[model samples]
Target: MATIKDVARAAGVSTATVSRVLNDHPSVTAESRERVLAAVERLAYHPNAAARTLRSADVTTLGLVIGDVLNPFFTELARAVEDEARAHGYYVITGNADEDPRRQDEYLDILLEQRVAGLLLCPTDRVSPLVEEVVRRGRPIVLIDRSIDGLDLPVVRSDNATATRELVDHLVALGHRRIAIISGPTSLVTGRERLAAFRAALAAHGLEVADRDVRIGDFQTASGVAAMGELMERPDPPTAVFAADNLMALGALRWVRDRGLRPGSDIGLASFDDLPWFEFVDPPITAVRQQTEEMGRAAVRELIALLNGRPARSRTLPCQLVIRGSCGERQGAQ
Candidate 1:
């Protein structure tokens, strides 16, 4: 088998240059990198990743633990992280927390056991002992999409409070005062901030939220469906309903259909996270479109910065309000 030295000789470059090319060092010239790659291919030179990692005592992999892989938002986030990490010559190991704190802890332990160079997590809980331990050990960590308070770590997420305000403002502009909401779990920052923003927006409009008009969901479809059912069954149902997440919005839609109520006519509907399918639905959903891919990319960048002994900062990106017929802003059929 050809060694790094053989590849270096074939490419007419120093062994260090060949090594730099293999590791995707940014300083290497494009021509040099191409020549090294061609020589590697010709010589069939394959570096032993395990031996290299062991010899260097450094991990070239990043662990990304998402809140829920089943959620398309998280899935897309993972894809973006993987794409960015690969571009930087790093690999990603992803785990799904399934929105369970215990499961999230388990995944954290598993990732740590693998000795990843860094961690990216959409935390299920605001505080975790395992995460604390990891931080105490001086491991690089960057929170994505969700965060825990009291933990000094870099984070990448959307500005939920602002987005919620925008959604509520849109509903109020459409003359909706008695609006109901399906909120996510209070334990999660995303859920709590959104619910608080909704209330604040209503207060700004001189409207108060009634207890009967609010239902706390688990950021899941079933919870949304159940919450919608409870709201619509009330003696005085709300004219507009907002779901904190996309899955819950879909669930609310199911409840509306089951009750023979047409969205955008009988009742206005809005959601937090927008998806491609939202546009193709019967009544296109008005939603808060977060920069999910950018969130992922930012998380990886921050983590890389931390790993490189640089200052990593927390960032919150703005979300766009996508107007559609579901919010009763436009007249439409079905």
Candidate 2:
């Protein structure tokens, strides 16, 4: 079947441009419209009827596309979104992107085909053209946990910069000068922000951030393990390590244990996300606690406002730094 993507490719334009031409949007240039129409005819493209019906019907269902279902952060977020949606007398359909851009795009298409009234997405590093088309059509789309550059969409997420600064400060206070970080992929706003904040925090304390001290991971456990191993194998290994997310942090902890190294005594450890299990670990991990439930509920509320033809605003929720035994205290002065 000839999808909108096919038509756009044939026309040498973006899907959003193709959509505008097809819908007779006034902003589309005559030449561009002619080109899109010709491409549509050549490809025998047919717009999905379900997409057309979405605007006309009152759908009480919203589509939620999360980055990774396996991550505890996203798992809790999904539950919160589901609960909040149900409370509003609406149901939700969720799709796991697994941090893959292709998978994310596929899910977006499937949700739109299912005639979802609105969408709440935890996008991958890159933005999907289909999402842009949906927004151009004036259908509601809210960003959850992550934001894309150049997209003015309503987003609900944590204040990563402040939280990261606090985490670094806590680590520095523990007298750790050789600090390393296992960061998520920089394509994501959260990853970029946290990494930048970590560097800034280090500089504020007269510490230089060495290139070798930074290890990029995919926000997965395996990557965490690999990154930690690499950092530890260095000639001058860091005395403290920070993992950007909970799953990676778990991986870091596993690596520490596999090498017979204790967390607080041999080396310090901390993470960006604070999961319930963090407190139960052998040496409870220090972490930044984001209000996942509030983030989910706020995303739903923003989406609902858009559905009701009201303006929706982006929201940044605060995060708390949970101090624990993972990063042991410095020698007593008190």
Candidate 3:
């Protein structure tokens, strides 16, 4: 086993520098840090995380607890957080909590036991006790992509309600009288807020959100397929459909094709969260684009500021509805 001295000597830097990098101190330069890491790898020196934590009494790590790892949105957010933390000389420990507050709480406790310097979370359930516990512990923290009401921590989120409302308004302007919506779990803040906005947008146009036209799923492809099928069953089927996430949108598109209907041509569609694959599909999907990358970078900037003694606050970035063929209303209809 290679020791810290060997790593330091091979990298041509002092042991102190190696220790600083290992400790994830923000002052370590990236080039020097990479050299040290390369040396450690070449020497096959694996630092015992437990031993290091016990000896220094500091974890020198950050934690990111997300709701769904399978969702590209969460995956992208986690990637941004991890990259930023690494840039700041901190290793990030990430895991999905399956959107259960209980699972989230458990993961929080585990990370706390590990004594990570900070955490970024897309929380599940009420999450007050977990938030209160972290605050009580005086750990540096940032909330991402969602907010917990009655909590004092800083947060980064896209303007969910306004964005979805704009999508609804666009469809209405294009002359879609009956627009159906498929959403993720309403228990989560994003889903709940988006649903609220969807309903409000319908009501604003004097359109009733028929119960049969609305469906709730887990933001998975299967759910989207099922929801679209249900909507198609309505006595007066919707003229347009809005899927709340990309996976569901893909599923809806699949069902439309299965029925020999062309998307954007035969049955109009609009959705939230644009996927890269959308551009390849027949007529590109019209979507309400959330500033996902911006949201990620902003969360990192906010988290870093919080770590640097900045006062905490929350921010919601704007989303835009892009006009595309999928959302164009039929001509010469009724």
Whole-model Cα lDDT of every candidate shown, in order: 0.91, 0.91, 0.82
Off by over 4 Å in 3: 1-44, 57-59, 329-334
| 248-324: candidate 1 lDDT, tens digit per residue | 99899999998888899889999999999988877788899999999999999999999899999999999998889
Candidate 2 residue lDDT tens string, 200-311: 9999999988999999999989999999999999789999999999989999999999999999998899999999888898788889999999999999999989888998
Instruction: Give lDDT: candidate 2, residue 86.
Output: 96
List of clashing residue pairs for candidate 1: none
Give stretches of model 1 more than 4 Å off: 1-55, 331-334
Candidate 2, pairs of clashing residues? none
Q: Lowest summed lDDT over 10 consecutive residues: which window, candidate 2? A: 325-334
Candidate 1 backbone overlaps, count: 0
Clashes of each: 0, 0, 0
- Quote the positional error of residue 106 for candidate 2 in Å: 0.4
Candidate 1: residue 112 lDDT (0-100): 90
How high is the lDDT of residue 81 in model 3?
Answer: 77
